[model samples]
Target: MTEQFGLFDARGLQPADAAAPPLCVRESRRARRLTLRVLPPHTLELVVPHGARAADVAAFVHRHRRWIERARREIASHYSLAQDRLPTRIALRAIDQSWLVRYESEPQAPPRVRVLGDELEVRTRDASNRGADAALRAWLCDQASYHLTPWVLREADLVGRRPSRVQVRLQRTRWGSCSSSGTLSLNAALMFLAPAVVRYLLIHELCHLISLNHSQRFWDAVERFEPNYEALDRQLTEAWADIPVWAHPDARRR
Candidate 1:
């Protein structure tokens, strides 16, 4: 369903006081309960089960105002776009590769990107952060595709499982997913994770081929392949902060 949004208002809220951020309301049939997501750069998202009321959502946000403020402060403390500008060098420990980034601008030059042994170069007429970030992201996707695809396939083969296809894309809040059809979609951001963590993610998804849901059987399968899966699973949650802000467009916006 299309996302909807609304302004939050309540009794005793003063007009002169600071206004709350815009609320993005999403209705999900699969959502069994209302949940709040306070994302980086101060975006507030509310996921409501189908048929939830606006008043219910507003009340939920209102009750959690203090928590939201604290969460935003925590995020601000950890991240600043000024410190998150595009990097001159990026290392992917998971893939054992590093890139030396160079941005070159020329008058009337068409935007282009090239990755040659350990160097990623972007040429554009406009040398703005946005342009450079976009170019770098495209290159990262290519690298993720080239590296992640083969690694996942090889691991799947060893486990005697096969996916119909694999796709690499920039995903927020997930490492990978395997559909019932056996198609696996991996987050390109896996390139930022550690090698062991990457392998655990592949095994986690591969097990889904046997059990689409995260049931006990799935956990058993994952543990069979990677005994250290639990620790790596915990690390995945905190991995987003380790990713350079330029790689995630949302984190880049301040």
Candidate 2:
């Protein structure tokens, strides 16, 4: 279940500001502790562990009030939150490709994405942008898989470590992850980043095959593979601002 809170202070009673953003509190079975997520556009999500009291949730939000405010400011700087707009052109910098996006309204036809040379035609049944967004996300995943799979394999060869499998997804909080089973999961949004940053991420994950934890040995391995891993890692974190707002998961939620 989800609940929205009004203006409140650390004590959970006094109104901090009338313009304060409403906080969405959600209970999660998998959550171990109260966590805060500032989603794109300007939505604050508070994740409460099952059985957590309302007071704890309120206090958690209050303690992170400054963080929430700063995150909102950063997001506002990076994205135009006024409306959910579709992209007229999509650029994949990692692969150095761009495509013009065109849309067609077909009330009776199911939503579909068609590739025509350097253009993507999105045919949608829904009047809202939801259908088109969904179609584009699917297409993006396919494109990521097609390009990233081989890329991962090639990097694996260079690193002398082969993953059990490689999967590309539109992950919200992670750029890439490697499971104990040697499966590498990469975020589809990597396509929006530079090739060097993407390579650093791949090396970072592939190095996990050597050491899963961020131990000194892990960093050593990462550095061995990519000498400039530190700078690249920082660039990867900042690259979130470069991703088009349409590609954000929050766009679909909106």
Candidate 3:
């Protein structure tokens, strides 16, 4: 079970400084020690192990206050708070396509998105950014499903391994995953990565059909298909910075 606590709670913990960003404390049964995470766009999460004393948790935060501030600064440097607003253009690099986004307001009507020649037209009720963002995200998922599903299928055939099903979604922490039952899941955010990087990710997941764990044999299979897997894997990790802030999983939360 997990529970969340705000900056100031009833546990007699020290109150957070007035200028400090929001802090969320979560209790985890599996955690052996307190760990801190600086989530993107400005949220701090502290994971507390079960049965931790409130005083200890407070001291932990106090001890790491400077580190927290530094991490926040790094995130701010990479992501501008102003970019949280609606996007005017989107570039799907994997497909080598760029799209212009146009917004139309319709009072009391449901949000909708349409794809024109090189543009995406979003119609939303009240013209709110939230509604438009949702519509665009839905459209993005559809686009991912349309392109990534077939791409995974073709790659599976080439690798001489097949999956029971392929799914595309807007995942936050993973590029792709394969289950023991042969279900392959791909992140919709792959659309923002380079074509070569996307192909490498697909190959990485398909290779899992041979070995679920990252054992020596699993890595051997990956190298067999992609000799430069190490470099491509590094590129995938760094590509997150290139993704539009609006498409991030935490964007809507802000």
Candidate 4:
């Protein structure tokens, strides 16, 4: 079931079934056309251009109803978050390291996570799966900060480019993005990708600081830094498949 929604209406769009996957409606100022995204967990998101009429949106969705349903079915049939469980032994190829994970349960204790040597340990008061997910994400963020920040700095220095700032976030669709102000935003999932892929991402974003788009100049600049960037870029496109289901707790039910 797909929950239907319009961009604007007096009482909003019609209600959907309780079992229906949520439908998100957003208006994008930069959008020149209507766009549909079938995100993880079979969620349907409709992006309408700014000032799109409600009647038009309704008709568009009606026309694409079958396509949306098929997409939802495909996603539900193929992608399973249960397969993404956090393992007791975790390998981070981007940083060339392996981790032995241990879970400790303590009543009335706050959830805590730490890394020692090649081992990662999580202490939790609540025995729920959600607690473990939170603990793991916290640890991943810590590791991403420790490893990715310096990697960016060293890579930037290689090209003699100094970004204004660098930030790490758990982004779903993109591995990294560079703002016009030279600020680099990296995905925490980069820790799961290969070293070459991670390096390519750093170089790719750094190149954006110079060219800002995928113009010929950008490729030329990227080549100056990484000769094998084209292959690495292609490899990066499939890197999301390497990220385990545990990495995305919110999409677990889907």
TM-score of each predicted structure versus truth: 0.72, 0.72, 0.72, 0.72
Model 4 Cα lDDT, one tens digit per residue, 1-254? 01112236423332253334344565544569988876554445676776678888888888887876667556645555353455688788888898898887787777877788888887877444346666787678778988999999999988788899999977654578788788888888899888889999999888888876666897899999999987787677546567765665344532
Weakest 10 consecutive residues of candidate 4 by summed lDDT: 1-10
Q: If ranked by lDDT, best first, what sequence of candidates would result?
A: 2, 3, 4, 1
Lowest lDDT 10-residue stretch of candidate 3: 1-10
lDDT of 4: 0.71
TM-score of 1: 0.72
Deviating ranges (above 4 Å) for candidate 1: 1-62, 73-80, 251-254
Tens-place lDDT digits, model 2, residues 116-204: 99999999876674578777888988999999999989999998999998989886546888888888989999999999999999998
Expressed as tens digits, the lDDT of each residue in 82-163 for candidate 3 is: 4457889998988999889998988777888889999988897764545787778888889889999999899898888999
Off by over 4 Å in 3: 1-80
Q: What is the lDDT of candidate 1?
A: 0.69
Q: How accurate is candidate 2 locally (lDDT)?
A: 0.74
Q: lDDT score of model 3?
A: 0.73
